[model samples]
Target chain A: MKSLFFRTISVTFFLASFSGAALVDDHIHGGDSHLPRPVVVEYSDVESLASGNDDVRLWCESWRFAGEANNLGPWTTVPVECVSYVKTYMTGKRYAFDLEMVSREASRFARSIQMRTDGMDAWVFDIDETLLSNLPYYAEHKYGLEIFNHGLFDKWVEKAVAPPIESSLKLYEEILGYGFKVFLLTGRSEAHRSITVDNLNRAGFRDWERLILRSLDDRKKSATIYKSEKRDELVGEGYRLHGNSGDQWSDLVGSSTSNRSFKLPNSMYYIP
Target chain B: MKSLFFRTISVTFFLASFSGAALVDDHIHGGDSHLPRPVVVEYSDVESLASGNDDVRLWCESWRFAGEANNLGPWTTVPVECVSYVKTYMTGKRYAFDLEMVSREASRFARSIQMRTDGMDAWVFDIDETLLSNLPYYAEHKYGLEIFNHGLFDKWVEKAVAPPIESSLKLYEEILGYGFKVFLLTGRSEAHRSITVDNLNRAGFRDWERLILRSLDDRKKSATIYKSEKRDELVGEGYRLHGNSGDQWSDLVGSSTSNRSFKLPNSMYYIP
Candidate 1:
């Protein structure tokens, strides 16, 4: 069973690599580079930014690796030295490539399982940065170096214009096609529920079993606790929780995590 | 308090980077390159390896990022296409640089805490690929292209000459200096305790609060269950388990996880 699963991924890897090459080439040389405020900033020379020393680049890469691996727990902000590095990564091809890898792995896992007729098997997804991209907002916020202003971020959220993370939307579609129920669980306050739904619908997330947001009482709790409790409630309702995807470790850690959890790369900000 | 911690890490990062540059230079240009079987193989041009396409490189790197983040689970071997990439990573500067980043962050966290007078504050570390590296053995094995052979691996372990992962050795020393009790919790069988101790001592891991190993009864258990049960025992003994570090997620996951867990980069193989 495992060998067959691996063989399928390897074959898929070849196909993805070819498609990914074209996608990357288009982004690198496309007309979007001419825009004053490009949605995805394409850097002709990534190292042109100051502090372009090899050591600094390696240090910043290592810092991101640690952050993704959850080694550096609960960091408040990107390191002052890593600001430009984060910007280049977030606004460049690497971030998209990373997401492609994660979502591919996730969809592969979801396909490997046998779906029950009862339809209890479910995949959980976090909303912001998992399904939606706040890259445009963070782009103006110095890629999260401005110390995360809630009022400013909430105003951006109220616009209901965040784009879908393309790879995640693909994963969402694949999971739905595989007959797994999709659940959108997020740390966003319930006050923004209407806008969140609008954003989700506009960004192509039209169907889900539920869109869970933190209530006033739940807002006071840490993300780990609130998300865990929400997952616990889903489990209590007899959902299998086969797969969970999130940009934050807090979304996957704590009690009642899924059979498999996929973490999307996020370097801008850390939420405990 | 957090800013002070970040400041200390930033200072340490500069110091470590300078020292790391020298270390990397020595490995790249030194006598090891001339050995019949170099201990740490250095590549003049990493792209010299076959299948060095840009897309394939990005794909392999994404695979690694997923593995390190625990998004990829329980695979027996590295992807066949990723063999060269994994080899380059394990024997190259990037792996060491990643380790430096993790250890530095871990030590920073350790330093930020006010150590209690009670000697109950403990740090847990895994043995193989965490404290002691088996790279020399894996280097001979096509960097894990060959599936794991227990007989051959046990023979290598019996030789009692595995080298210390230098960065982790430094972390062990720093944690000891900070008044934290060091506990070596490994998945190695208890039958190899003597050689394990001899190997550890030879590699400069001279002291620890305890060296916990798997007994006969533990052979049937998965690493996650075995390590978690052992950690539960430590917790039962009134130890705080303040920090944990390991190469495999199985060593860091499960019950009694530390306040902070450091994951070292290991793309060669996955252990469940």
Candidate 2:
């Protein structure tokens, strides 16, 4: 039922009638006694019919630019109405483009720095979709399908069976070869640290430096704020964040953001 | 009654329950075979609860920074639940801060330029809430309280009686004093041109350049896209936009967004 609580796939049915403001009759019933009103919607435009709302389009656009969105869950695909859009997004060709971006960023990062002589230059990588591919899981679960099963996901993590994201892996290896210390930063709770590490290792991620995980308290904060604080802490330690990689904008734009950041693609879920 | 379609004051009653994704149990049946489900909302923070959903908050923040948000109407006050928050935001003291920002920007623009010996320097300002204050009208109407009456609003506009926003008035005069050509870029259609000009004059905005209004087709585009295209046209004409001022972010951002842009305070209504 927890999964069912989130299964409203067609936003047109919900948002169109209301605009979240259009109430029943002429007047909006006051806060004290307003009964929930049924939503009535009519769709005319093909493009709009393809997606939920402008918010959805903005999410896709923002993710393209900064890998940012509310982290709801992968394959919880009800909000995004356009079937072909998501299909094209999940294609291998798109993956190649994302990898190309990472490669280009890595090359740019390498060319920009003089290889700091004294301080430890660090590069942060968000685990889930940055270094490893979750397409298999998403393929099975599918967006807007059954609700995300944390236990199942945990088991998947424990298996450490996810394959390496080739482009990110290439970028990872390239950065390591450049004498930069690599750290892994993820939103996963610290409780899952051991399995996450094992997963990273099994998926061909060899790391030198720390693996940062969110503590229980950090889970309550928004992803952007939480990640920013983490970056702040990293900077406080006198480590220069020269480069960063993640599949979310929260990983890239924030307090301790490095000189440059690279974002991978993951439209299966949105994490705010 | 048609005007009433535009107003809804409690963002809480609307946005919270639905996220625009929550469907009401009854009226939704009119649209299709949509079901009514009990909504389960868990609010952990004061901030998250102040507005409608994360999307709304994101829109507000984005509008603050880069001037991006879905085209939610200004009085769509159905989801923003924090009364005191909106109260503080609408305060004259806060307006003073906004004006101070405008003043500071004006001074900065004045000091930075060397009397631009090159191309014809230009400045763009949006009409509503930029040169004129709509506080008096909104004071009576109040967001989300009554329907937005176009005839009544048109009567108000036809009066050519909107008072000059003090800070913007100062900036407007200052820009003209410095010999920069001024243009009013607004989403208001061409039919409103005469009254807009009269309103501008009554509001003490006298200028050198032009007042560019939206056409029938241009009205369909988003604010950013429309404003950007206008700026593109200006650029094509070889006008270098040196400064822009507006109450909305769309005016300040986009193509030919001058050397700097200033945004005024007007949370009373959101325009796109």
Candidate 3:
């Protein structure tokens, strides 16, 4: 028995050793706290940053590349590779393919569950990138190559004209069909609920049981804490959050993590 | 107040706009069910994968570049960039540097906490990459460039000559000096406790109050569930887990997550 046990540990070590890439992919939901603090350089560092620095590259690339969900930054100047990444991500079909893949996975998860029919079976969806495409807005703005502009994007949101992400659109309909209550938990402020509702309706989203936009009170709370607290409320009311999907880590990470979570692709930007 | 509220939501949309990269870094602590399931492909797809395939690149790049924690298997034939990543990561100073940053953060967490001095304040450390360097073993084994050899690595473990990671060694000592009880929670099978103790002692980890190695019965438990369950046990006993660090995501993620958590760089390997 002992010999056999040693053999198993040995085998685990072998398999464990080979997948080292997994370590580098530490996407932060809470405090990963292991990565070196991102170099928040001044404008002086931009020239040297563009020229070459692996540390800066790693920091910038991990933020750009690894996909921790967030919307916090006065970012360093964009890297040359990032343009390629953004292009490949936005212009190409890969983004669409990933969404299709996730929707398919969500469909599978929804199908496997036997719903209670109590209106207590719930699935949460984060607004913004998860359900809607801000691509057209991003495209006109140099694909996020330039620093983000607040007033302009807010003005853009006020228009309530963003289109549905085609892939998520399918998943959204399918989940509604699956007898689960749908909750739209968005970072959009509560004041914008009417526009947000109209936007979701116009974009082909319909029949969600609740559109829970962030209240003014939740402004200072981190997305994880805010979302999780909301989820706790739902759970406290006997809701079973079986499905959660979002573009940002905060949407699905931290407490009250869903029974099955799905992350879609969006490589052009990050949110804290 | 209403105008100010709109302003906040508007400001959020802008930060939310540019950072699409978070979609790629799906850091897994055991199973963040939402992480886009890694794109697994058939062996037949290698030719297409090696060619300019965006899906393949996204799949390969997220795993290689992002910092997810696990030792999941059937990973894609690692891309060329990953090889370079592994080489640069294992051979470079980044790993140690990240550890230093985490240690410093942990020091802050430790100092901020007012421990009861009931001697029940504790910290948890995962063995293997967290405390000991398996670099020597990996060096001989191409730093996991090749398939791991179980018998060979086990023989290496039996030799019990792993060195202490300098940064972690300091943190361990400092945490100990702070009057916190130390626990080494390792995934190594319980059968190896004696050797594990001798090895840790030889490598400068002395006076740990308890060395908890897994029993044969734990084979079916996922690391996150298993580790979190153990933490629950500790918490039930009224020990406040003040700090935790590990090279693997499994070491730190999930329920009873510590007050402060730190991850060490180990792009060379992952254990689920």
Candidate 4:
């Protein structure tokens, strides 16, 4: 029984090490190594192990996996690239470990906004990645390939097929319940208003009083300018903005006043 | 039937004559009549007449008599005092009507802001009667009171029990859908943020991104100066305000660069 257990542990370690190294190579070199790779483990497996008492299994199920017992000594530490590769791989899974962590962080951030009561009682949310998910379409069309095909992009938006992020939708509804009027400020062109409204309704987002979109005619100014201007306009009307939430750093930056910001994870992609 | 119609027409004409005479009397006396009489016909009855074609029935209804055709001729045109009394009676109802109309107008104004593509898009909306329905509560708790009881009003707001005018809620939602970030500027003290947010939430308003209340810490300034300072703050942030909506002329007047103003009906009821 002891021999069999050793053999099983050795085999698991070998497979984990080989798979980790292969993932690292795939990311760094953009080529698949012809090594027999283990099936990607679900995040749930790590969660279950988190409550268990098996040190070897725990390390194996972690974002990094040490080598076999013979090679697990101090001198045989795992490569940083392999650990990063595993983390990236885990984050890519639909039930990703990093997503859970990020989601918890997001919840904490949202609660903090709710608890504020210093005369500022408003929240600004960016539309695209912050509330709605447009990454799939962007990826399918390869929008980042040097030249942006706005006509095609507009056509995609007209379809209004983007889905809302569950966590964001919940936060939005909660904020509304809190009497913080939610303003949806999007970098999307004004031409997309009809489709945006339809999509929001379809996605079950509560109706809002203002949906500030990018101007179709003057494409000269940056989105930052447009958003900042919109923020000022709100201040002019007497709203004390307390917080802002967005996937992009640019979306949270205000022009007139300093606002509390909560960043959503979006390291997988970026939009101009 | 013909006689009845003739009698109805005669009564209307007589009422018109009496009303004309009363106007002249009012002008002559500068509205200081020794005899305390009701002003105009009850607006509710007038509304009923407008809704239906029963002129004779309306006249009869107002006078609370039937088939007294002889009594109808010189219809003392319900005194202007009667009209004033009826208006006072309908103050609550009229205010509601005014709120609905103003809300719709405000929505149209907000749309105009969204339509502008040449400059930085922004809109200003008045707080108090503009965004909230505080009149009923105020009148109910402190009838004809000149000074606002901040503590009591704050308690009312914290309860968040006010029903928002349907039209305003619709317009607020529409504006947010249009992507215009909303600012809820108010003359209320900054300490009112909690209650204000609670009220807005209770009222189902959306997209309220900024709540600019009067700072209690700062030395009191003229209403115009305070408003202008807010406007400058918005301008400094690069927002070219496209429109403004407010119950008071001062709220609209202070935002000088606003392209247009949607004046809320307040000829009969002015706050302060």
Top candidate, metric TM-score:
1
* Model 1 CA deviation exceeding 4 Å by range: A1-52, B1-52
- Kindly list the interface RMSD, in angstroms, of each predicted candidate in the order they appear: 14.6, 21.2, 14.3, 38.8
In angstroms, the error of model 1 at A271 is 0.8
TM-score of each: 0.80, 0.43, 0.64, 0.33
Candidate DockQ values, in order, are: 0.20, 0.02, 0.07, 0.01
Per-candidate TM-score, chain A: 0.81, 0.72, 0.74, 0.58
The model with the greater TM-score, 1 or 4, is 1
Q: How many backbone clashes does candidate 4 have?
A: 37
Per-candidate clashes come to 0, 22, 34, 37
Best by DockQ: 1
TM-score of chain B of each: 0.81, 0.71, 0.74, 0.59
Q: Considering summed lDDT, which 10 consecutive residues are worst modelled in model 3 chain A?
A: A8-17
Which docking class does model 3 fall in? Answer: incorrect
True contacts kept of each: 0.43, 0.00, 0.02, 0.00
Clashes of 1: 0
Better of 3 and 4 by TM-score: 3
lDDT of 3 by residue, B1-272 (tens): 11111110000001111111112222121221222233332223112322334344444344443334221222222233355556655665444334444554466467667878589999999988888877888766655444344457667777888877765777799888889999887767676778788888887889898888776566446577778888888889888898888876678878887776666666564545
| Candidate 3 Cα deviation (angstroms), residue B260 | 3.4
Better of 3 and 4 by lDDT: 3
Q: Report lDDT (CA) for all predictions.
A: 0.72, 0.53, 0.60, 0.47
lDDT per residue (tens digit) for residues A1-272 in model 4: 11110111111222222311232121111122334334332323111222323433233332121110001111112222233333333234321222222333334344555445543466788887667766556455432221234456567678887776655676678777666767888877666788899888887797565788776442444455667788898888878776677655446543744245555544322332
Q: Give the TM-score of chain A in candidate 2.
A: 0.72
Per-residue CA lDDT of model 2 for A137-229, tens digit only, reads: 666665423334555666666677777776566667888888888888777778777877777887678865888877766755556677788
